[model samples]
Target: MSERETWATRAGFILAAVGSAVGLGNIWQFPFKTAEFGGATFLVVYLVAVFGIGLPAMLAEFVVGRKSNLNTIGAFERIGYRNWRFVGVLGLLTGFWILSYYSVVGGWVLRYVGGSLTGAYFGDAQGYFGAISAGPEAIALHAVFMALVVGIVAFGIQDGIEKATKLMVPSILAILVALAVWAFTLPGATPGYAYFLSPDLSQLRLTVDTTPSFPWLTFGGPLAAIIPFAVSQAFFSLSLGMGAMITYASYIDGDESLFGDSATIVVFNTAIGILAGLVVIPLLFAQGVEPGSGGAGALFISVASAFADIPFGRVVGVVFFLVVLVAALSSAISLLEVVVSYAIDNYPVSRPQVAVGLGSAIFTLGLPSAWDTAWLTWFDTLAYQLLLPASVLGILVFVGWVFGRPGVEELLRGTGFGDGVGSLWLWLVRTVVFLGVVLTLALGLLTLFGGADPAIVPPL
Candidate 1:
């Protein structure tokens, strides 16, 4: 095999990781989910979950990747845990499964970028979104988006993924900072900030009646009702549980501080998510559109409609959607990398060939979702409810139980941290992180099979 590729710089690696985490998950999903689940109430739960559960889980993937310096599957086998290679296999599958629908969403962002410049969706944002969200147009755009991803990955790591993300991540942050400043001056900005940042603890503990029409109705508490979605949102927002991190970390050239880098990536990702909410939520409020009014298309429909009446609306819309497009492409690159890295690591195929071939196949798999919005919704549910949580749980188990001390040592290298910290991290992964994921996965299954409240489960 040819020599493995590595990141051009430490900053390049950090930006690439942040780019992976700071995509549609932050821009498209965060505001809508915050709106749907009582605004700041959801925000609080999401923060707790991100730090408490998401961070440790991310550390586990970092350990595996940098230690073995290989793709997810080969990382396991390289470490002499051949049987546990299934964990990496699951991650590869999760990344592939996710990008199928993720590409569909990326296509949506691309369409919105065009529509913003032409004011195509200004008059009837909802109608326009409904019209273009599925069918031939969506499929065509999805293929376009996948082609962009394939083109980038075909250029190899240093020239393609790293360089692209260096530009994209910084551009995204700069645009969002400007947009958030402008959004603060909107008439309803106060209420929007209050809704997004001010916590209402009662909403966090809210309950629901499963069946109001019959005696079979069962009531569920906040813990059972809300934790799964919040946890899944954390996983989704940080790009955890998919081995995207593992694939990216494999490119690191030296012994960097994994803990420090993990924390930096987490901070950047979470900040982008909050900045997105600041921009979108206030804009929705400014238009007098109630939160959650637009359903699954909340970010697209609600924000686009709000732009119709604002000053310089067309220009603002163009800039905003351009930010979304950049974020989407950055994330799509990471997801495709996971699959492309696996193919080149294990087979005789070249990077360009694997990128194009796998990109085409993934696009074919996503056609169902592109053909119908209902299929998109189904894919979203399956990801949050099963694929993400399951992949995360498996990785934690491997690092904590299967890989054992060697994995902990990998994590602590170059951090100047003692064995005590490693032991604590391992303990958290084994117990808190592990059990928390188990509970999240179990609750997701219950929500799927036991008919949990639709309000608690994210319909998106």
Candidate 2:
């Protein structure tokens, strides 16, 4: 209607965006990937992708959403030529697909919050986690979790999404930092550090080869497979490419320099994830927990088991779960904002109608996920491998080709940094930057499916 919606305040906007960036992926995905792939090498490749690839692509999406002031669908149609609507539609559907299970996992975080607070999981948390990982309990919790999301969206952007995030993000960050400091002193932490912080090129070579025991994917060698995984994790950890960032950017009101904002978000998101690594990995090593178990319960099982053994470990467990709970909800809210904004902008529907209708639809789709770990893994892998990269591809096409250099330059005009290089930057975005993502995606797909080899490096 009237240039869509804007964030209530700048602080809310940053927090909401940060909330999306910092989530369970930061806690679970980053650490596990690092553990399995070789700590510093994986971290190194991941950092490269984050700044080299993710930063450019994120700025591209910001240009599209902020300039047009629209959700994924509207942003695409307004910017691109014919048939781009299909791409736009795909992005919107990806958002829905992500929310379905993201909220479900958010519910698990809620469950763990109770588990931590009650000291329920402190004794046999491995068994405790196994029992509640899926089925009706998870579904019911998901529904309750979705309702909370609805309440926030119902209040609209400024008052609802922004306000809650402003309080939640800082609190989440603070607690997580404190927990990491405490965990640094865990007894078995030396071996854990040896496993987590030490660089092992031999180990990296093995994982890159996709050894049978460490078979997350197949490639010519651990190095070959790792490039794609690192690239994907970099994007995944940042919550980039999904309409979450694009839609969040759509609400911006000023020339606050998209690169600076996006960079700030990326730095914090990566730090929180590294902090998670510091806390969880060393503890796993300390407890004699196997780094080889890169399954669904990376943090929930091994790390949780470690929590049971420490002095006042139960207290630590509660605080850690609270960190997860806050991070999950904050991300869930950012995702829900995308869908709600879609309906509000495109239809005559009220925000409440949009939230309830779409939220229910997505929640139904997530049933199979809650029923089966097999399905949940498939969904998570699909989102990480397919939807996320595709979303980045969409932005590459949108800003690099559709809107062109002049349009992008105009968006960055009022910024404080280099003002004259807009044309040069736009040219780079259209050609080099866009092509790099394409090559990464194409090479990644080939290396993933085509390059099957057997190897396993020793643990980091």
Candidate 3:
């Protein structure tokens, strides 16, 4: 049997991890979510969730993967907990589920990148998006995106994943910073900043306005509704609740500051998300756009439309979609890696074979989502609302109870932190992070079942 591969450098691992974390969630979803949940108030709640919930959960996953020094499923098997292996399985499945539709969305970004350069969608953004969103074009683009992802994964870790991220992550950040600076210079950009940075207490209060409809709106105040969204975003944005991080961690070659690396990923990811809002919100407000309806089309329609109206709109559009393309590709690589790692770890097959075979299967599974909007919506809700939270809860149970003292020792292996910090982290994962995810799950269920007001549901 061939030996397992490891990351060529600690920096490679960190860049790869950060690349995974900063994805479409940062570039596409964060700004729209902020606009929907009352701007500044949502930002505050999101920050709290990132530190309070996201950080600990991420570190916990790192502990398991690094300790076991194996793929997600292999990690649990090596730990000698047969039952707990299910968590890894769940994560692996979630990664597959997410990547299926995720590739479809990545395809949208790719299509727009081309459209931007050729001025294809310049005049009618909405019409163009609607036309391409769920059709043969969408499917073809999705295949192209998946092919790119497979090509990367087929190259193996250091040469493929690490090197790609090292180039992609820095470029993503630089583009975002430059766009944000330009956005702020636009006339009437202050309103966007105000809406994004100033808290509204009324928005924070849960108040439902009922209607005799299946998808009702139960506004559970900002604290009840918005916080859950923030928590989920933090999880999704950091690529938690999936085996992506675990699989990436399996490539680590030596002991290092897992805690510090986790923290850095969170910081860089959050900064990019905020900077995205800075660019998007101000640009929209300056152009007298409201990011209307906050659908999947929000970024494509409103932001793209704004670009159409601006000087050098074509140039801006190209840069913007290029950023999204990079972000999507980086994240898609990680999601694909989780599945590739599993196949390689368990089966006697070459990485290239697994990459192509599983990549094709995922693309086939994602066809319904590409062909129909409703299927896409349900798949997204299923993964994010149900599977993701449940997966994280399972991890918490395994780490907090199954691994117990050994888990803490694993976490403290490289970091100089004493047992006290480890104990506190464990407690936080068991109590705060666990409860926060539970709340998110409950809220998601409520929204999914039409118990909550549809009005309060974040834009699709």
Candidate 4:
């Protein structure tokens, strides 16, 4: 058997983990969701979800990975829960499922980067997206994006994943901050800031009377709906429940502060998410365009149009799309890594072979998404609304019940914390986090099957 590859340094592991967490969701989906919902209220609820639910659930995955020092499925096996290995399988499948469509979107971002450089999408942002969004061109772009992801993962953990992320994550942060600063300088940017930062309590108030509803079902109402959405966003934004964190944590070699590391990753991810809103919302407002009005093309059309209308538009467009490209690649690498790590651990295959093989498979699966808009929407709804949240709920159950006190002990192993802190963490996981995942899963299913509007459910 070959020796397991480990992250070369603590910082490398954190950067890789942050790279996994900070993806298109942080840049595009989060801002759109916030704008679509009551922005400030949604932001406040999302913060609560991040600390209350996201942190504990993340710690649970970290405990399994670091304690067992194995791949996702093997981590469960090492923890003496043979049947629970299926949870890891679900996590792997969730990552693959998401990346299948995610890579298709990443391909769009890549195409836009080139288009932006040449000012191809400058005048007609919507038309440019329409021209490249489907058919053979989209497939070819998808292949190119998948190839970049495969190339990175094929080099194994230290040489490929860590080094690439070390450069990409820092670059992503810098570009986002720069863009936000530039965006604020625009004439009408203050309204955007007000829309995003100022809470409207009236928007959050439930006007409809609900006297006889079930307590759980009562949460389905307008104001209450934000809770589940916030929880789902926290899970998605942290890259939890997809085996990415578990796989990344498995590469850590020494005793380090898991709690502190998780905190840093969360803080960076949330800051970037909010910063992306700052950049995107203000720019759109400056152009007299409403944020998130472009639906799935919110980032592509609305933001691109705003860029085209600005001074030095071409340069800004190029830089913005470049940032998107880097963020997309960083995330796609982690998604592919989840499947590659499982294959290398279980099968007698080389890393390069597995990376290529799995990359090809996912790209083929994503072709339908690249070919048809309806297919793309269905894929996103399936992966984000159902599979991802379902997988997360399973993990919450396992850590809270099956892993129990032993899991808490593992979580506290390197944190220099006592049992009291560990117990508090465990309590939150078993109670609040567990319920949060359950509600997120339920809300997602309601959106998919119960004929609920996505605007209300807000796909995480």
Candidate 5:
């Protein structure tokens, strides 16, 4: 067997990881959820969830990968817990499941990029989306998007994924910052900032009096419904729970402060997410488009419609969709890497062959989503609602339970921290983080089956 590839530099790994975290989840879904869950209200909860729940969970995966220095499943066996390999399997499956429909959405972003160039969607944004959201056009775009992912991963880590992300992540941040500056100059900027930055705790109070699937939500009211939503959103946004982090961390070389690296990745990811809101919310408010009015189609419809009326709308649309396209590719690369890492680790096949074979299969799976929006919804519901949270829950359990002392030791390596911090993280993983993930999964399930409005659930 050949030696495993590692990131050529710490910056490469950080950029790659941040690139994965800051994707369509930030640019597309974050804005929709902001509008759906009440602007700053959701923002406050999301921030808490990110630092509180997401950070520790991310560290747990970091410990697994850095210590084992292997693929997700192989990490378990390398760590002397072969029986716990199933946890990694679950994580791999979750990543694969997510990237299937995720590629379809990436294709949509690709289409919008072209549409923006020609001012195609500006005339009838909603109608254009409805016509092209699914069918042969979507399928072709999906194939194109997946092929880009395959080509990158096939070239190995440092040469392809690392080099590409180093360029893309910086571009994403710079462009978003410029867009946010432009957005703040709009006449309606005050109301938009007020909506996004000003906290209205009352908006979190869900007035739903009855939840047949999970009655506790009906009683706990705001805390019950919103907390879970925020938790899942943070998890998805940070790209945790799907072995992408684990796979990325596996490429680390030296004992370079995993905690610090994780913190940096989280900070960059959150910054981009907020930057996206700054640009999107203000643009939507300026055009008098009702935020969240278009449901999952909000980015294509509401945002596109806003672009239609703005001065130099065509240029702005091109830049914005270009940002989304870059973000989508960054994320899609990581998701595909998770499975590719697994295949090259366990099988005799070469990286390029495995990439092509697996990419084709994933593309085939996404064809259903490309064929119909309803199938896309089901794919999103299954991956985010069920697979993701469950995968995170399992990995946390393994870190806190099965992998115990060694995991903590691995965590303490680069930080120069004493055992106390490691122990505390272990305790949180064993208890608080563990319970938080369990609650996240349970709430996700309830939201899935409880006849809750599908709009409130995180789409893609």
Candidate 6:
């Protein structure tokens, strides 16, 4: 029998997890990254990444979660050697680091949610974003954001996040799609499409002798960029390489097909992400907004500005920002749920108390991120570099090396994929996924310490 908590219904479970995956990353971050990176070509690379990097890595998490049916740390302990416990602990720390900045960003969204109603950031959007993005004002908003997340976690999994998502995800999707539809009707979209969809040819000039920069910006530059982008995107999109999914899976019941449900979550998440790009890229393209402003607050600022100049823009602004507000909360609830689930599963801490503790901690730590964008970048880098790679590597080792092939194969068999998973996957888990993760970790570490030209380091 599966030990993790299951959703009261299949619909609740899929929607809740999808709610977690389909958030600011897809909506807010996707448009900005595409524009900033190289437009349509980058999107092409990213979509490839979604399939190769995200799909496989996601399956790995599903297998681990459904099999063990325990909270992160506990899941590791239950599966393999005592040392595996450290992996789980590391995952917890990873989540903590991510949540610190994530909560701050969440607050920024909350701030906009409130501001959109008043058009406070509507005029001179760039300057307004600069003024409020990092400071005491940001801190206050972060606290409010953390409080909302804590409130949901306190309410318990199936009861709170599931219910909230049931309300939030649909609204988030509806608004974004509507916005996309609106964006298509406008003009000046050709350049935006060219920049985002058509690949620039010059970036492809680099060959083996010369190093490439922004290859996707050029036509047929590096097919390799697709791998890192996809891997990283998968990590970001699934919210995997972190403990969130493990925590959610810990609460799942065994009778249902974990694979089937997880697939639904991934597809829904991808759709939302694509839809967000639809809203963002076309809008900016149709307007004459400079693509240079694609920063963290770019989406919030740009989208609001776009709406402000349009007919009936105020209502549109409110509707669009509300989409972001809901998306942020959905993901925030997942992050909060990680800790809250642990408290309920492992300790006698009442659900409400669990929420209070985790929420307070997130709010407090989130202050630094809110008040300092530098700190936010640091936390994101650390989470992605140190915590994620290490944790994923640790999991491969635990399942492949520690638990051995038989144990893992049994878990895969637990699903309807049946014996079709077979010896090949077992071999891959042992050799490819496990070894590949270690190498990726090494490269990530190297990138952290090894490469640094004077221009990059001092930014002269």
Pick the lDDT winner.
1
Error of 2 at 342 (Å): 1.1
C-alpha lDDT of all candidate models, in order: 0.89, 0.74, 0.87, 0.84, 0.87, 0.69
TM-score for all models, in order of appearance = 0.96, 0.90, 0.95, 0.95, 0.96, 0.87
Q: How many backbone clashes does candidate 4 have?
A: 0
Record all residue pairs in model 6 with backbone atoms less than 3 Å apart, i.e. clashing. 4-250, 4-251, 4-252, 5-251, 5-252, 39-196, 40-196, 40-197, 49-230, 200-218
Q: Rank the candidates by lDDT, best first.
A: 1, 5, 3, 4, 2, 6
Tens digit of per-residue lDDT, candidate 6, span 338-393: 76666677876677887888888878887777878877766765565457777776
Global lDDT for candidate 1?
A: 0.89
lDDT of 5 by residue, 10-112 (tens): 9999999999999998998888787777888889989988988899999999999988889998999998899989999998888888899999999999999
* Residue 78 lDDT (model 5): 91
Better of 4 and 6 by lDDT: 4
> What does candidate 1's lDDT look like per residue over 277-356, in tens digits?
99999998889999877667777888999899899999999999999999999998999999899888888888999999
User: How far out, in Å, is residue 172 in model 1?
Assistant: 0.6
Better of 1 and 2 by lDDT: 1
**Model 5 global lDDT (CA atoms, 0 to 1):** 0.87
How would you encode candidate 3's per-residue C-alpha lDDT over 372-419 as one tens digit per residue? 867787787677677888888888888987788898998998899999
The candidate, 2 or 5, that scores higher on lDDT is 5
Clashing pairs in 4: none
lDDT of 4 at 82: 86
Kindly list the per-residue Cα lDDT of model 2 for residues 147-241, writing each as its tens digit.
Answer: 88888877787888888888888888788789788878877688777766666666455323345532344345456656666777777667776
Off by over 4 Å in 6: 1-5, 199-230, 404-415, 422-424, 427-443, 452-460
